[model samples]
Target: MTSARRWASVAAMLFALLLAATVIPDGQVFACTPTRVWDGDGPIWCREGMHVRLAGIAAREMDGSCRPGQPCPEASALAARDALVNLLGGAQGRTSTGHILVDGPTMRCLSTGNARGNRTGAWCAAPSFGDLSCAMIRTGTVLRWDRYAHGRCRSR
Candidate 1:
């Protein structure tokens, strides 16, 4: 072939090689190991195989009793705690004071009175989930039953 044709062919081959390199997945580059744990209020970037804990609050009373047009008198703030335990496949236990222990995450109940009682709070943490970013743990996931006894099932 001519010199110009040969150079064109070489350029095409180089371009194809570059494209392949960009498209192909590099196992070494993609492979990720477990992340370390840090203290404080934040998220944790964890590996798939690593274990973690999410701390939060649990509702003290969750009775299914209410009247029409009223909220439930008892609310359980155990959404995130429950979800984390389910995801990690860990057992849940409780302390003598009724504190829930799901792996490393501890869920404590703040109040246990009527619907208008003080709202409960919880703190959830996963050491091996993601960085201490806002996206890691959501507020609603660690929610409080604020509108207790305010919905349609309040009287009951």
Candidate 2:
């Protein structure tokens, strides 16, 4: 191969390696300091760059709609979102994209091998809230998704 071609190939390989390094494997346990929240059942942006969707629960979408078969809670979208932000230590501010910056404590999350778009489905535990999934359910802001919950909510 020409010198230029060799350099391009090496660069491509390095880029692939970098992407793989950021991919969290199924069932991996990771810690994330949540910096922003999209809604109650999150796509919470972490300081580490991992986006987490709270596993075992469903909340109203930001547009105030719940996808057909998901547990549609009685709570409004803003209600649910605000409740989650409060649980995370309250909203620090809002981003240009409309996500609320949160002052939540660092949380240890267990990935459940599920993905929704780019976010990982995780069961996370915050210091103030032992289990976020259960806490959301208890607040009536979200509902337990039994398929993903796997009886964890029952015990809690």
Candidate 3:
């Protein structure tokens, strides 16, 4: 890997370790309370104004399509979406894009970088669920996306 990418990966790992250990002061972590779920693997809208895509995983698109190179779990799109909503606190409504509005439990995340569109790629952990990506994978709703995982999912 390029030196810059290597350093970035190292940085993300350190940050993730810090977050998982909870060694830093509470407010020091980038905490987000989810306000919406776009799918099983997220673009989880956070009340904190961060649009977070759960790093290290992929689920079906809202219309049940999986990207050509992504890991596509056997679960249907709605099933995966609902699983995420349940992980969060459940949906309050739906947006025009069919994303679910939620009042989910707060999460602390380590930002890896930018994801597709304007979303931030992050490995997030909710209080009740521990690691969100791992939880999603356990539910059989999402697949472990190794390309972007950077070993985060395995660590959890």
Give the residue spans of candidate 1 off by over 4 A.
1-76, 84-89, 105-127, 132-140, 143-156
lDDT of each: 0.29, 0.86, 0.81
lDDT of 2 at 109: 90
Measured with C-alpha atoms, the lDDT of residue 106 in candidate 3 is 83
Point out where model 3 deviates above 4 Å: 1-29
* Tens digits of per-residue lDDT for model 2, 22-140: 53567999997889999999888877767888899999999989999888999998998998999899999999999999968999999885565667789899778999889989998
Summarize candidate 3's per-residue lDDT along 61-101 as a digit string, tens digits. Answer: 88788899889889998999899999887889998977799
Error of 3 at 138 (Å): 0.5
* Best candidate (score: lDDT): 2
Q: Candidate 1: lDDT over CA atoms?
A: 0.29
Of candidates 3 and 1, the better by TM-score: 3
Per-residue lDDT of candidate 1, residues 96-145 (tens digit): 64334434332111211212211111122235433211222332333222
- The alpha-carbon lDDT assigned to residue 6 of candidate 2 equals 100
TM-score of each: 0.24, 0.84, 0.77
